[model samples]
Target chain A: MTRITRDQLLARLRQEIPETTPWEVADWLRDGKEITLIDIREHEEWVQGHVPGARHVSRGFLELQIEMVQPDREAPIVLYCAGGVRSLLAAHNLQELGYTNVYSMAGGFSAWINAGFEFEEPRFLTPAQRERYARHLIMPDIGEAGQIKLLDSKVLLIGAGGLGSPAALYLAAAGVGTLGIVDFDRVDRTNLQRQILHSESEIGELKVESAIRRLHDLNSDIEIKGHPVALSSENALDILREYDIVLNGSDNFPTRYLVNDACHMLGIPLVDASIFMFEGQVTVYQPANPAKGIEGGPCYRCLYPDPPPPGEVPSCAEAGVFGVLPGIIGAIQAVEAIKLIVGIGEPLVGRLLMYDALDQSFRTLNVQRDPNCPLCGDNPTVTELIDYEQFCGLPPRS
Target chain B: MSTIYIPTPLRRLTNKQSRVQVEAATVREALQALDEAFPGIGERLLDANGEVKRFINVFVNDDNIHTLQGLDTPLNPNDKISIVPAMAGGTVKA
Candidate 1:
């Protein structure tokens, strides 16, 4: 008997999949019965053109500010991005999260443009605006509302290096309402490759401040809040609650648990992602649903009942991460956050996605809730926040 | 007699022995037997009222005892039991 290669098996699986098209959605929209068309592309993309009268919320702000921005949760909603990849993904995300009538413009705005629709001319920028937004406007996915979402979003980044870099940059360019950074360390030369939030000139400066300076320069509309103090048992939950979404980009376990617990208790959906060398994992943690049986969603404690003994696992400093690993995973975290905020897509609440950069392979492992999890168990024992450092058996900084 | 395998963190109480032999018909009995030999090791394994800590996981060979009867998980003679602390990493930055 011959063994089938992985590619052959994947191709067979792809063949079995059904097609998703926009004409069905276009027809649905044209009928004008009871649906809202969402132009998921950037504001510049929307300004230069969009489906007329379509809501102009960008993907970045949509997820973080959904409850505030989209008051009618029951409204039939459809989303479209540049080429439809992001929009299709966003539509599937919305469907997964209990949105009944979500749809994606199958071909997205590119297709919309191809259909010879009229568009608002791209706006001219002042010299300062040009200097600040030169890189962002060039990218179709992150033009105007995308940049505005960056300005409007309040994202809490647990780490300033690696994964936090791209997440912050994209959020800034997308115009997230506010960007909150939590990092106690100073910029080290080693962080430049992946921690794009910091610059070589800013070495030895606080990571949060460095990120703030660069982000402010990038987009003055964005509010950058810096928390230079380390996240600890005393302040983790409170700090996390202030932000619309918490991005876990830290390189340690204790902080991950703290962030998870805070998000779970606060009912603020968490956009979680992690990187280890060449491999990375991304997931959304929604505390509202326990039936999904996802550990992290219930709380980090649900997944990791206890922290590995100190030194049992090597740190990123010791294990050496691929320079680009955080970039990929961090960007996905931003996507999940935006999806959650806008209430547009299925927000990875129950699924844990893993990426192996070496083979360019992605896999997901089934995560089950610990029936006896202290945080979200049938008879939960942990009711309030405990000192994360104490929970992890770490000493407080002097 | 069955052997109990202890993970890295709790091994200091076991004299750094990965595996130690103890005689007991049930998991609770085996833990008691092990506790008699090593005084403080049981505290880490069992809480104040002798309930297992939520973080410490016990396995009879490959199957987790938590799915069975937890500390009361029955163990036949010659069975292998292993205790491991869950891998908890990532959270907080200093």
Candidate 2:
């Protein structure tokens, strides 16, 4: 309305707002300063590249989403754009909303690149992906960004049996990009009672082979890898290295300890679940990764240092699981894996969730990180994966 | 009186009963009482040293006994004690 040109307006705002150069922002981030970075550029510009660890809140949505990102008005916040101009506007708007410590990146992403600073290329959801993950996108928890994460994540299932059946189904349905299934056993009629991923028509077929066909029919776009071999300590580390996370549904002590030790060594979180008769247990064993800032939890060895003496505990086949137990437990494992991938919700690390179907109750017990744990403890032991079968007191595989 | 949740594996020892009640003041006493009611359960839960086997976890209410006072953890009235053993069943193995 007033006779002010764009240059004149920019000059006036420059004096009113506080600004920090890309060098200063880099120093703050390197020093681990408590600062929130918001990229106030359009979606296209942001997907190309942006300041690493910056939240993308386009200029149009800055006012709407700023509160959710930074509730404390006095907290340090930095906003950047393609250049430095839009960030100034975003900072001004935030100030009007009573933000007291907002700073604009002097030259935005352009300045960051010129300064030879790091930038991250964010993955975006395609139009078809947008429609497919529309429900997830609508939720504030798992938006477009989170949907992209699900697409880029790879999850490995230790088995394609009762628990793996439902877990893989939901993980695939949720659009997890890569699903690797390791199972040497073939589908038997007994498995059909609960393993929904296999059908009666597919009896005697290799479980991994049957699983690939079932998952393809469910989601053709997703990649399904079949490792039709037994998972041994010899191969666990190599196979687990390819996955972002592991879902353990293994039925034997040798495999459980093997997978657990391998995951800990790799610093990959494991969503471990098991069913016995009508009862089930679910917990996440996350090894501490100091570099990535992931807190450690009580690992499998911490909870169960050694397997029950042989013959004292009945085998799963003899235990006789209920038809619906694995369904509930496996779905929970899938949910935990998704949470890990999207980085949302309070993970079940350091806690064991016990489900008693007969009583219709869920119980959570705290699992402590044993200071004397042999695998993950103050003093180091178990430096590498060992013979799980011999350790479990079972006959070694020949 | 406190309630001890007998896991499915131990159900056979407790006459196929899932929940067994015990009258005791400490976890050790409760487990002892459980043994008196259901013979052979003590052997299944305790090792040669009369302590919970390394593979088994004992809980008082929502906390593991290891984090508390171990088997000496005191139990209040109607408190729930759980004896959890690591289960490895994921498939209907033959």
Candidate 3:
């Protein structure tokens, strides 16, 4: 049997496969029809820009990963590449794999842009920002649009210690427009082991102050708001209202519950992370926004209804955390926060990511909304923020 | 026998052992075995109704038991079961 050349294969597949113009696909998306658009490009091309909401499966792994992405073979699937060639081949492969309604975009991404169809690209990047985020701008996922979203987004971090250190650094470096840090504690000598934001000279300085200085140094363009006051019921809502999302880096149960309730009430996404010893966990608590295409998902309260009795759970100090544990978890929180702001990729709204550094393993558990949750449940009894310190068995703040 | 990997928070209950080998055919029995070897372990995992607690997740060979048969999910020998609790700690230091 004679093996066909690449050109011959392309010609043969083109003859049988149907092609859809960029305008037609754009109209389908605009009309809110249920269709799956896939980008079969390399990672470099994908990060530069892609059709918003289009799932990316590189040409090399299309066969391996397509089943997981589009399980229903009968679903309408559109594939596009830089040019039309790669996606045409990918569409042919999908058809061969029994995908009944597969179509290749006639002119690929460039043609889509030429036709003035809505495509996602990095826009409004200044020379400095473009240079600073060159790597991100080049990425199809975090290109100009995603970078702009990061710059336009506001994120409040609950604590400026362990988890907050890495999260603040990365978010600021990633060019998050505004960062609000809530912390009243001073940087202690012990914090130097894990809190990278503060230096030895800054010991005894307020954490929020140190964080602001360090984060500014990292990215002078972004604004850093240092709230050097302890977050309490009196000011939690007011402080949180200014931000689009909240990151819970507080260690105590009271603050955890407080942040959760505030974010849930405000209907803002919360990227929550925790680390103790060699273990860490990260999850995003994004309440449903039907208008934004986000399905209603569980909040933190849905996972752990009530805080564990104060003594039942140990803090990082008591358990003696691995120095780098928060770095790992906090970085993940930054990733989730960026993804949420950019509206790209799957956020961890209904999933729990557990990492055990000692074993070098990561596990994600499926989390669902609890109808009985007091805060976010179907019959939520917690319409207002209460005294979380008392609820978590901690002494009321003086 | 299935190997159960314990999370750090629960290591104290298991005497700091990260992984424990237990002879059991189901997830429930494995929990019972863990409790037998280490007292009070079952209480943390199951509720008053003997159901897996809402906050706890038990995975059998990387597949969530919820998607499987819940507590009755059959366990084959050499399977790995991971018991993870809901982690909520966020403070830098206590």
Candidate 4:
């Protein structure tokens, strides 16, 4: 028996499977048709460049992961590789597995690149940025493109206390383009334990000022905007409007509810985290109609219809918290924010994650949109930001 | 018999017992069993109409009870139930 050469195998597979051109696929994508494009290249090849919105299932795991990528066998499937040979073979295999609408791109990703078709490639990184984010640029999950998204994205943090401290540091070091920090408090000796952005030397300095200094020291290439005023109904929307996403690390219920309402009104994604004692919770509330592929989900109000009655929940000062708790939860918030900006992987939208440091366990729960929610519900009542301090039974900011 | 997993926030009502075993064929009955075992725990989970509270999510195995059959969803002895509450506070330090 004679063994078939690679060319002969490619010819055989091409005869059995339909072939799509790079231009045609690009056109189909632009037309907004529901199609699933799978990249059958190695991890390194995919990290270099590939078509946007293409599901990556390397040739080695093509069969094993195809079901997870495209559950519907009838969905239009297009497979591509570095050249076209591997995709042709992979397309044939998919067809053998009962996939009806499978096609192999004739010239694969190389053809797409050569034709100048709309494809996603890691952005060109400066030598300094490359060095700073060496670990990030190498990871298949967050390559040059993700890092670029981080550098180009704008994030607003509501506080510079415990939760905000770690979130701001990681986000700044990650090279987020513009970091807008809103805080009016001064660093105190009590904050030294967990507020990593401030040090003992800066005890009396403004929280946002100290934060800006620390973040600048970490990554001077990024821009830092400090809002020294309190976030109120009058200025929350205007201040939050400029940022792509918001991270609510505010230490009070008034600010938490205000940030949620403002982000909801402005249609900005929010990464919310709260810590009390050894337990912490982190979740993302994306805009109503999340980016394509993400499920449309509920906002913070949908989870807790209204803020807990004043004093119903104790503050960290009343009930001491583990110093490292915010560090863990804030890091998760940073991860969720980056995922939302880069439009990659499954975000925590509509899901709440609860962490208990005492028991060392994490529980995730599904959050559903309530048609009766006061803010994001169909019968929506809270149309604009209200006086959150009054709403939370706190004296109005003088 | 099914095992119900309680979340941290509601653990105070359950005597800090993370897992509780009960015998019930449906989710509603399971909640009733949980209430009997740990008094007043079901009140936090169910409203006056006996419907699961809007802020609470109950999952049978990996499927949310709302997507299944709500309180009527049938359960097997080997199935695991998880009850989670919506987290809503960040003022850990005043």
Q: Top model by DockQ, which number?
A: 2
The clash numbers for all candidates, in the given order, read 42, 0, 13, 4
Range of the 10 consecutive residues with the lowest summed lDDT in candidate 1 chain A: A12-21
Could you tell me every candidate's TM-score relative to the true structure? Answer: 0.54, 0.82, 0.71, 0.68
Q: Please, what are the lDDT tens digits per residue for candidate 2 over residues A47-95? A: 8998888998889999999889999999999999988998898899999
lDDT of 3: 0.86
Model 1 C-alpha lDDT per residue in residues A1-398, reported as the tens digit of each score: 87998667545433432223556555665687666777777776776766665777777766655555455766677777778666765665565555665666656777767866644554344466556766766766665545444445577888878888899888777657688999898998988877888888999999988899988888777688999987877788778888878888877777777777777777767777877666677877777645645334445666458775565444556566789888899898888876665445567765667676766866454444666888877888777777766666667655
TM-score of chain B of each: 0.85, 0.94, 0.93, 0.91
Docking class of 4: incorrect
* Top-lDDT structure, candidate number: 2
- The alpha-carbon deviation from the true structure for residue A288 of candidate 2, after best TM-score superposition, in angstroms, is 1.5
Residue A46 shift from truth in candidate 4, angstroms: 24
Error of 4 at A226 (Å): 1.4
TM-score of model 1 (CA atoms): 0.54
- Candidate 2 regions exceeding 4 Å error are A1-41, A44-121, B90-94
User: DockQ scores for all the models shown?
Assistant: 0.19, 0.54, 0.24, 0.19
Better of 3 and 4 by lDDT: 3
lDDT tens digits, residue span A9-50, model 3:
889888878889998998899899899999999877877888
Give the candidates in order of DockQ, highest first.
2, 3, 1, 4
Per candidate, native contacts kept equal 0.25, 0.75, 0.43, 0.30
